[model samples]
Target chain A: MSDFIVGTCLFMCPEKERWMREREGLLHTFEVDEKTKHLKRPKADPSKIVKCFSRPAAGQLMPDTSELRPASVLLSTIRYLFTNVVTRVDYDWVMIYDFVFDRLRAIRQEVVIQRIRGPQSVQILEPIVRFHVYAGQRLCEKNISVFDTKINSQHLLECLKQLLVLYDELEEQSSMCNPNFEENIERLSIGNNRPQMEALYMLLHLGDSSALGRGISLPHKYRGKNVKLAMKISLAWFLKNYVRTLRLIQKLPLLLKFGVLSNLRLLRRDTFQIMSAAYNSKLLTFPGLKLQEILMYRDVEKLSADCKLFNLSFAYENVQFDARKFNKGLLLANPDMYFTVQTLQKYLPIILLQDDDAINDDSSS
Target chain B: MDSYIMQLRRAWLNQDGDVLADLLSLSHNHATNPQLGSDAAMTKAMEHLSAPFDDLVLHHIKVISSLNKDDALTSYAHQSAAIQSLAKILQLQKDENWMLPVMNSMCLDLRRLALKAEASKFGKNQKSGEVLEKCAECLMSCFRVCAADNRNSEDDTKRWGMLALVNQLWKVYFRINKLDLCKPLIRIIESSGLKDQFALAQKITYKFFMGRKAIFDSDYTAADEYLTYAFVRCHKESAKNKRLILTYLVPVKMLLGYMPKKSLLEKYNLLEFWELVEAVKRGNLRSLEEVMNKHEIFFISAGIYLIVEKLKLITYRNLFKKVYLVLNTHQIPVASLLAALEMHGVDDVDMDETECLVANLIYEGKIRGYISHQHKKLVISKQNPFPQLSSLNSN
Candidate 1:
């Protein structure tokens, strides 16, 4: 029944003439029954219909002429409605109602109905249906507000949890249906699905214990097999290492904050770990993932954090940081390390610790 | 002293080098005697020997005789006599080996006399100008002679001496405000294949003069290139010369879309420019007016009043940054932008004027955006509005 509804929503316009002809034939066969006189008809409002066809369908479809046809009309219809009319904040309740009555519960009915028809396989349709249901639920949760103006993060987290569950189930079904299902779908959906997960991760900050653990766990399940999953795992690792690095930098002494030779050993260790994760995820070489800006942002944040630590140490202990000594130490330890530290120091202050007399005496000696 | 003056006048009337040389040499012997070092009569006798001479060797004798006369003659008169003797010695050509040293000292004395004349108000007469012009001509001839001498051209000392002579010629021209007179000499230097052999300091001075000339002629592009090169290559230890370079360089840099940093300006003691820099950044016309009124003499003397006043366009460009941040979107309503402009002291600005400003900014490639006159809106590109300000180091 849900497949029929999906089919109707997708093919409602293109198949309208043939459906009317068939209905006319059936009506002629029934010969004007009293029960049929009270039947309700679906109404179309032009203002409510926004042209929200996905790019593939919109580009392939020819208006006023049927030159090409969609492969899965039902999926196309649901995709259009899901992206356009149903995703609006003003229609959050309507979307929720549709999720509860038409999508979540009714999709199961279609599955059962397909099962009852024969011993035929419903595996191919199961993941697609589950994906639609999860997408609708996530959208409804994102747009819906518990209060007048604010959204509850807890509710969004719950939606994320459900989406994760559905994602796992779909993965299982897809694998059961086809051995290369994940790879094939990943190639086709790389541009579409990754942003959705990233948006979810960003919205939750992925810093909470439950969200971060779930984020890490879901990607681990597809370890080394999926590019998108590897990217997510890499991002999770980057965020984890970034927070740890920030905390470590904050506790560092004013002298070490300059990232001299001894300090750079630890910094290099952390950088290598992050970079290895990025490399393993193929994000280092991935053209679509431009992480250079993000890496630069991390470097800037690390430098600023070091500066803040230096300032804090100065304020509390009355100890000063000498940039020249720090640079000398860097040079003594290794000359190659000076270039990057010098560049980073441009935005930081060159704090003077020793008195002018002391410096003069030292230089003269 | 009276007998010496009589003998010098008789020798001059007789046109006799032997008599003049004898009298000058006798005065030199008495002038160096420690017993008469401060004697008024001895000083008066020395003054008679320091006058400009007609004979080349005799003038040489007189200059050599009065070289140590402290109170004998004014420095201008002494330097004039020395340059005259050097020019005469160069013309005589008795010894080729002495040419380089003679020319070097002549160039040094010419520079001293030119600078002294410039400093004092006593040498603005036609006679003084004619004498300086002759010194310039003599310096040019020495440069040609030294440059033509292949043996001396490769000698670092002689090469540097000749280069110094050229630099002094430029200074004389600058002091006389006849920079045009140095064009032929500069051409000679360029064609002589010695242009690249100039030391860094000499290069800086030459380029600075060229840049100043470009600025006066309103050729800002050439001026910017020359001045920026000079400023960048100037010796870090020479603070006074750096300040002089910045006096003309700051305004040229402003025209080239670079604002001098306040710290840099202050380091050079150009603190008066701080207000202009601030007013241009904030588009504060009133503060700019106040700065102009306070430093009216400075601006006029620096010859940058007009250039500084033209910075109002950049002021407008900066004012647009506030509008960009306030609207917080690519598309800004023209009316709101106009209101912001008016609030920022751009009085009575209307939509057309605002759109024109936007058009000019887009045309200048400062802001990457378009103005939609039909919709009465300014649609700026969010990625890079006002790209010129992005790379600048903010204080």
Candidate 2:
């Protein structure tokens, strides 16, 4: 289940049409029955649905698609049902709901849903996306948060560009993936992979345009079908550029903001610990003291208990003295006095013992 | 007269208390004895005794007071001296408590004569600063004798008496700013028992450190709160742990204004980590922990503890579980975990399993789970919110 959620997070839509089609199949099961006359409930087929989508992922991702009206409508409807519906829906039903909701958002099909439901229902979907993002962020932060920095630096750029392309492809392919009243029967492939990098590049260029203070310009060739493909090509350009790739990721302001950093709670401590260790290793080899490493366990009581077992001999003991004089430069005169005293206390006795026998022999001679 | 003075000095050097006493008695006796009293004899004896007797009495009193235990003859010797000689010694050693009763008698007559002289000299309704100044001078002279002779005085009683005298002098001196005169007195107290003097010094030092006008002038609220808080704790026993506190506090004080900046925070974090590493290399956990706790950098503290344990300077039994849990929750790297664990001689364990356990533990600290030893495997079970089955399934 964890792997699947992570995998879904990593996938870019439109290019991954099979994932979108699978989402449609899941959504089809949740559609209101026409023949039932609003009287009887429709039966849900458990086996046909993806196991990964069987449970409701608490904080699902939703995006704004103002220009892609049809895709936005479908997204908004699924968003309402999953996030706002508030039924005692089983996990399988909820997963199916997310699959459809996310697919609709990805394909930009909200316009058709808006025209179908009119403005009021579609307007409500906007808040649902906003609210769920907040809710998910809160939930995730309350638990352990980790950021995977394992991906090679080179691949990082490509990953970001692909994500943007996936966003645009979802907007373009909404109708083909969405259930239509006029279609007699159709089976859409929902398990094949497509290179969705270009569409993401277009999203980056589009997002960056406003950020850079450039007015939005739709290319002359980007009309209808050509528009979606043009978006794909632009996303590919974004994927190819490493510097802009980060910017593209940065452009997805919703997911990649400072708030995203909160998800990387461990990153802060881990970074500290690693750097500390590296520095200590260099220091320990440099000269005199052989200082021990310190592990600060989270539990205070446990840390205290561990401290009790610390060997006083192995861990060097240092004595401190404070001589206060209000005048200037008093500290510099005997600055190393405490260090000298502690070191002397530690090693001087042994040296003294070694000299004692020699001194006695010289006196006898 | 010179021959008589030389004779008195010889007697004092010989410690012939009786001979010195006879000479003092003879002077007063000649003052009243009508038959034996003569102007020439009285003047000769007073001149001879006055100068040598004053030095001799003061020196003997000092020697006596320096004795660690009470001597049987201390009270007897004070009574035998003529009031003139006694007055000179008592007035000079104003801080001495042992001479209080005898000094009081001499001071009565001397004070009366001084009051009469002052009335005649300064006229009526003088502001009395001069008179108070004279009294303070007398009081300070007495305290010096007592302090110089303090070696014999018991530590506690001597300290209390000295504190009372110094307090009196301090009040008077603050009005006049003649603090330099008290330098010898302060040194005397320092020599007797320096360790016991910190509380006294701390009270004054804190006032000096906090009462600086700059902090009050700028009105930086955080600086005010922090500096004030520090000033209060500055006198604590732990405050005597200066080296440990300063390592963290110096940096903390510098960064107080700069901390709100993200770039500054990043730099501070790096600096703090480097400092901890330096402390670790020095093999001084107290210094390391002091910095860590003062800053409330629990993760750094835990990291250092792990490092110490790995170095064979400490063991990693009870604490490893908890620290591992915290770091794990932070999604600290597996390689980092492996490195930390290996430093503690836990290198024999399977790296893969250990990494998973550590990762789970970090997550567990965040999730508020139980990361404890159960059946010899480190378990990271989530708390009640996630449902028992979910945890069981994860396991």
Using lDDT, give the best candidate's number: 1
lDDT of 2 by residue, A1-365 (tens): 12211112212222233344444543244332344324344322322221222222468444222222343333334444434232323433234334443443333233222332222222333323322322233233222222112221123234333333333333333423445533213112210111122222333343232211111122222233323443332332222221222223332323222122222223223322322222222112211011111121223333223223221111223211111211222111110111122232232222211211122111111
- For residues A155-266, what per-residue lDDT tens digits would candidate 1 score against the true structure? 3344344444445444443434445655556434322342243334432342233333333334443432222432333332333333233333333222222221223333
Write model 1 residue lDDT over B1-395, tens digit each, in one string: 45655666676666554554454442345435443323454455556644434343243334434444532234445445555565554444433433444455445655565554544433222233545665577567667655555454244324444566777787677555576777776676667666787778778877887787787565677887788888899988989888988988887777567888988998999999888888878867667768877986687556565566556657777777777787788888878877867886667456655655565555455667665544666677768777864343231
The DockQ for candidate 2, computed on C-alphas, is: 0.00
Q: Which 10-residue span in candidate 2 chain A carries the lowest summed lDDT?
A: A330-339
Q: Specify the CAPRI tier of model 2.
A: incorrect
Off by over 4 Å in 2: A1-365, B1-338, B343-371, B374-395
Report lDDT (Cα) of residue B278, candidate 1.
86
